[model samples]
Target: MNSPLPTAWLEIDLSAIQNNYRELCRISGAKVAAVVKANAYGHGLVEVAQAVLEAGGEWLAVARFEEAEQLRKNWIMAPVLVLGYTPPEQVVEAAKENIRLTLFDTQTAIRYSAQTSQRGMTVKVHIKVNTGMNRLGIAPQDAVEFTRWVSGLPGIEVEGVFTHFARADEPAADTTDRQIRIFDEVLASLRSVGIQPKLFHASNSAAVFNYPQAAYDMVRCGIALYGLHPSPETLLPATFRPALTLKTRLTSIRELDAGEGVGYNYRYYTSKKERIGTIAIGYADGFRRVMGNKVLVNGVEVPVVGSVCMDQCMISLDGIQGVQVGDEVVLIGKSGGLQRTVEDVAKEWGTVNYEVVCGMADRLTRRFIHSNDKKG
Candidate 1:
């Protein structure tokens, strides 16, 4: 572990993660392949991967080869997949590390034929079908031909076939259904060619909660495992809780008078005398300036009375008492006597719920918290 920094920490609830893993399995008919990419959505890759493994995750996925390498460096022994672009040149090292690669093109597979030859003894791969997302993966029409040529190649294991969903969160249901239909067709085409990749997956957080029909041999649980719904109304089982909490110290307290302005451009002007608490975290620490619309202090919703400077923001402590220096200020997570999950931040920011808590970048020191003080 690195030396602990004095900055505000994001405490992660390990127990909640375990609960989410169990709940994900209960809802998903297939086994779970937990997506731990983007450092497990900024909760720390190795830590969250370990938690998911402990909670019974069989496969782990990252968006790139380096993330898999990092996890392997920490001795995380599991089937780690590289879901993003993997240059043919990197295939040799990826195979050596036993990392799985996703293939979307026959040419890319051919270029890595040498690595593929050696990889039979070392690595495996999944074939990604574009289906309807059209972002990555082999086009549905060509996926069969692509899979056939690669399946016969040396040093290759046809591990899985998968697709991404584009509109799973939109209340209108037609688009997600269309995406699923195309994906099922791709699977049928693969079976027609006598190719049955062992695992098949089609769920992001949105689809896993809303569409159970798409879960094949596995489901990729990302944001949901961190206890965040894709949207407020996104259907979910009752067991999940958010694993991350963002908190900082109140650096100092200041008395303000009526009509006094605060922060850059003076976005807020006090209407009456009040106590203002300046927190150490600001836009520099991953709390977006857009979130200034609403934040909280001691369970009372408070206005961030400023333009939100780089390293600090102030919250008005009006209609409250017992203001002091060094008091705890929670931007996300439970505090004092109330719970403020990232879903709250997403609603306040009017953006995807994943981006809200994932907004807590790695720059912030993550101090792991537990269900009680004794374990901490």
Candidate 2:
């Protein structure tokens, strides 16, 4: 293991992650598929995957074939489903590794079928039906025929059928209900033709909490498993605990004169004599430059002063008395009565929690801390 770095680091609570997984399963009343794509939303893929399995998750889903390959190489033998496209050239190797691929087109399914036939092995695939999300998957109108074509292919095993919700997190349900109706129509068409995949899943994190009916056979828990609601508009039970805590120590503290400016371009000037705390983290560490003026510190919400540097940022400490050098600065996490969640930070960046967490870079060390471990 590498020694801990002295600069900013992320603390991931493994037990909290497990708790979130179990709670999602309990709420949805369905098998849970731990979505570990984007390195488990930057919480460390292998670590989070292991924790999900320990929490009784039935499957693991990733967005890339490389991620599935990496999991296999690391001896993660649990079922891994790639939720996105995989090149036809890699189909045979993917099958050999026992990684499940999402199939949405007949051409790609034929390629995979041919590869599996050559190897004398069956490749398991999940049929992705596009109910409403226009980003991927075959259109719902074509899903029944596509499923039939794929199921009859030489070596293709239709082990699952799935779809994605476009706006399950929204309070309004017209669009989501329409998508579900279309998906159900496709499923009924397939069953009428005597084709039924063993697994049927359509619920993402948002659907898991809000639209339990979409949790067909397994619920894919991505953001929710990390203890973040899909959107701030969502209100889930309080059992979900956020597992990632981003922190940096105060590298330097200085008292500034009333007219003195801080950081690049003099964007911030002290209205009066003020204490400024410089933290050892900045945009390079996935702390977005847009977050320069909004963040949390020492259990008090504080404004970041001036421009954010590549490696550091300054925060005004005028209202926070007695904060000294080497104090732990929380960018995202609870400190005493103050909690800065990823959703709050995302609002500052005008994005979502998924982007906020996935944007976290790898240069900073990740310190995995168990909930049961007492801090020294």
Candidate 3:
């Protein structure tokens, strides 16, 4: 017996991810670290990480220790960096697995040192300087001092020093340049005291194109790795192809006469005789209620005509011809000459592309497509 078909599914092209990694590498002219945090921004963490590694990417950065641990569990031995906080208790396990951590707080550094020292192991750490982000990181004025203090610890190795851009995605904003100047000053301070770490990086995806000068030793490619522009103002070249496509099949269709109501609370009403379609996708599948406005059927744009439910939604097939039950409906991806991108969906949802993709529910089955697969 075969397993039941998924109502909605995500098709992830691993080849597209690899192509994007190579493009980022060519553009940045630096070692590109693939940011696979947030489950590779909801593209399947292990699968995306493996794809990047196959594409000559050596480093994998995640937002938390658990993500790094998951990578390790999958036997992915790439140099993994936890870009966010790692609990004091997990420092030892992190060290044992050879995971690099972002160090900013003195108390956390002290705990890391103690844990590593007690275990007779040394853990590599990247010092994060708060170059105007005002989020995580040591104050710029105190970065040198903190680096010196942390360097003196018995089991902690200051392997890298980095900062994050606050507004690199905005081309007209001067915040990126200001942050670059501040970071350069911090690097100069560290070097003056002979505390130059092996790596110095400050470029995120947007900065990779907007501020190439800030691409120090390595560049962190997150959204771009998935072929997404960092922001509306910072567009990537046309060559970067999006790796994921959302699709579902129409399950049922019904003819509704004029004055008929549809969906919960009767939010939609038929103005004329219309063919309504019910697809096997809804908010539970990451198609939010607000997105009930449009989808693609037979390469034609159709209007979603009702309040989206938890497991289903309704679309008006009023003039579309030859669209039958079980015909493929595209929520995101190209259909004929028409294309719906994450950015397009983001615009409809009043959010960013990152949230639109990352918010996809885990229940939605992911089917990876690797066109270049030669392992067989």
lDDT leader = 3
Which regions of candidate 1 are displaced past 4 Å?
Answer: 1-5, 116-122, 372-376
Clashing pairs in 3: none
- Give the least accurate 10-residue stretch of model 1, judged by summed lDDT: 367-376
By summed lDDT, the worst window of 10 consecutive residues in model 3 runs over 1-10
C-alpha lDDT values of all predictions: 0.80, 0.87, 0.92
Order by lDDT, highest first? 3, 2, 1
TM-score of structure candidate 1: 0.92
Query: Per-residue lDDT tens digits of candidate 3, residues 156-192?
Result: 9999999999999997999899999999999998899
Candidate 2 residue spans exceeding 4 A from truth:
1-5, 373-376
TM-score of each: 0.92, 0.95, 0.97
User: Whose TM-score is higher: candidate 1's or candidate 2's?
Assistant: 2
In candidate 3 the C-alpha lDDT for residue 260 amounts to 98
Please give the clash total of every predicted structure, in order.
1, 0, 0
lDDT of 2 at 347: 80
Candidate 2, 1-376: lDDT as tens digits: 4346558888999999998988987898988899999989999998889888877766999999999998998889899999999988888888888899999987788788888898798889999989989988998888888888888888888899999888988956689888888988988898999998889999988887777778888888899899888886786578989999998888898889899998889888898999988999989999988644565676788888888999999988877877778888888988879888898888878889999999999887888878856756
lDDT of 1 by residue, 235-337 (tens): 5566778788888877888889999998888888888887887888888777888635555577776677777778888888777577577777788866567
